[model samples]
Target: MPVYRPSEGCIHIDALSCLRNTGITIYNSAEPRRDSLEVSVRTSRPSCQLIERIESILYSVFQVCWLEPEQTAGKVKPFFYTQGQAVLNRSFFPCADTPSVKITYSATIKVPHGLVAVMSASQWHEPSADGEFRFTMDKPIPSYLIALAIGDLESAEIGPRCDILIMPPSFPFGGMENPCLTFVTPCLLAGDHSLVDVLIHEISHSWFGNLVTNADWGEFWLNEGFTMYAQRRITTMIFGHAYMCLEAATGRALLRQHIDTTGEEHPLNKLRVKIEPGVDPDDTYNETPYEKGFCFVSYLAHLVGDQKRFDDFLKAYVEKFKFQSVVAEDMLNFYLGYFPELKQQDVANKPGLEFEHWLNVPGWPRFLPDLSPGDELMKPANDLANLWSSPEVDLEKVKQIDISLWKTYQTVYFLDRLLEKSPLPSGNMVLLEKTYPKVSKTKNSELRLRWTQIIGKQKYTLPIYRALWASSETARKLALSTFQDTKKQLHINVQNYVSKILM
Candidate 1:
């Protein structure tokens, strides 16, 4: 959690302002002595069910769930994990609960004799025979980055000085970029190993989010949006720009889903979100930061015009702000100063395309990048979607294109396209199940998730909804959040049906 890491700690203004504006009396308004900043918090009484769980469960806000045995790395034993995406870490301990504050920490975690313990640290040392695990993070990080997982775990080396940890199906997040150890949902273990991009997303965080952090939850796009740009940059290098654009196409669809569900005017959809007094920072998490944020960064890249020059500027930007938390202004001013010609052109305030509007307004992004490059990879998926959506289907023509030949993302892309043209004729739906048997029963979670959503829109099946639910309380919370984000996009009847299930 957010334990003080040194002889001194700074109290953030957001926490103080929240107390003052939320009708709490602040006895001291002036700056206090270095040893002094006395603050009081109003704690909530846990409900009876929560209290019972607190006593008997490992369900801390750090999201340490009760251990269950699993057959991993050839042995079956108990394992449990912590998922602290957004700001869940604040619940486990007292801190400002914002991304602005950074702390350096060393931890000694003890566990059962047979289990292993890990944390988000620069270096990890195995436990002593007595079961004491020691770790250190010399670099400062936000409290949200403080993570831990304990288990009878096994690791397989994937790269030099790197080991991949396969998280359980119940892991709340797609992946967590916890410094030394990254946690990813086993759903990414799509038999063909196509979901390696999730790993790349987390690894990209080492530079974008983990190193140069957002100053507050309001500027969260700085973390995720920048990471999305970085992730695409890396993928473009590995999989070509067409494939990168294909991925961006997927992201754009998600952004549309988010806007449609939340509505363009929803408070959380704003690039610079406003966190109300005493509001949970995690409540503001949405696609706006990651996808919409990417649009802004992409626009900035276009502003520079030269890929090599923009790439150089990006390198210099990281070198300038690494190991620090920053707001949008810091990034923007730096960019303008770096490109004096663009600054002289007054590009930051170019009429409706102003940087101010991009940061403060909420809706679909104004600046759409050249995703036409994606059409090369997207055309097949788009054609297949159009073919299936047509009133009269050509079975033989569809068979000409084998679904098996497409990469994992292509299938994901194809399924996602079908979702956009949802409520396919029942006959076509049945035909889809038969023609593509793998689509019906594939173990790929990404494909399964999209397939289930498509089914949910059409039939409102109970089993399809249940598939979205995970057993752990943490996973349930995450599932609920996802439901909230996209429920508006569902038919009224289906929305009510799923709401009852969630309740």
Candidate 2:
């Protein structure tokens, strides 16, 4: 029976400190009405505390009815909850989602035989069979972060530090890395070579992101960006550094385009969350946030240059913010505290070299030539305003080019100007590629992303797909963003590529 409403009052949760001293049993049964459960010791707090929290969150977001908590043998039992949805809505409950929630938990669950039962942390003690298993989490965690799953799963032991789980026929593409419990979708079992990189990306998140999180969604870049960076490192470690460098270069290129196009309305640090009258909690996933956030972090890593400094920055950020929420300001403050040199320079004074342009501006940069009313068009007789303006200028050639040609060329030129003026030369390959090779350079990220779209739609190449997946995470992500163009059938083609790479 349902027992709560969504919009409710403040329900303070004093830590469930005595959970270990009490008896708690979780049942993952076959009863479709309420398949899973949480049975914890009786306390002074009413069972409504857990019920109210779950009910309110589910009702407000998903608008679904969660089965009520029942009292049996002086303990409380909560109902079945989807593990996939829970990861996205980890903030719904006040309970810590971090693995280090500082409380110990023990669970006894039952599922259909031959299916594995998984949760956070390592399986404490040996797992029981017959779809029944007992697990203890010595580490603490928030309620929302607590997870349980039961399905047809096969696992490959990929060495001591890594393991790959393959899901049954029903799950989605790729998988969710929940530490020892990586949630795999049935699609990934397709045996595609490209999926190996996707798997590595998710596995890296377990430690870099899920283990250590941002203080809130605004600071979500920490979780995503850092993880994005870590994926490259892991890719380098497992694959090779040459591949990683090429991939990173591609990402930077795509990121430059991403920042320039999105405009000023969608800020990286935007605080407002637009929730519709009725929308699924998972519906908010968007490209600008995840992809661009990763780019931003990569940008910062480019700024620091030294690997030790970069590593220390991440390690320190995680250590300091470990059980807390953080914001963009916090990230800047932390970075500035460690690197005072960055604080001393004025962003404007640095010109195209500084983070101020990308970080402060609301949208991506555009290079189209200004064709506003009353603007002078260069003519055969157009006088050079500056004495230094080349006297040998080809006015006839300039007149022959159409305004649109000028605009395209202008965009290419502006990007070149940024590069000539910037400090780090290595990170601009993608940016250069986006703009056509001016003086015999190479294709930038914008061009690569567009190229991928053009080629991806017409014909699929395993190499292009691999290059898209392996080149740069930023470029791959940017290419993914282009699929948002609703008019273009390219999006569906790209999704096919995503499935191939991810599957």
**Candidate 1: C-alpha lDDT:** 0.75
Flag regions of model 1 displaced more than 4 Å: 1-64, 68-77, 91-96, 458-502
Model 2's alpha-carbon lDDT is 0.45
After the best TM-score superposition of candidate 1, give how far the Cα of residue 135 lies from its true spot, in angstroms.
0.9
Clashing pairs in 1: none
Candidate 1 has a TM-score of 0.79
Q: TM-score for all predictions?
A: 0.79, 0.51
> Which 10-residue span in candidate 1 carries the lowest summed lDDT?
48-57
TM-score for candidate 2: 0.51
Q: Against the unseen true structure, what C-alpha lDDT does each candidate score?
A: 0.75, 0.45
What shift in Å separates residue 193 of candidate 1 from its native position after superposition?
2.3
lDDT for each residue of candidate 2 in 341-374, tens digit (9 for 90 to 100): 7667542236664444444554433211112211
Please give the clash total of every predicted structure, in order.
0, 29
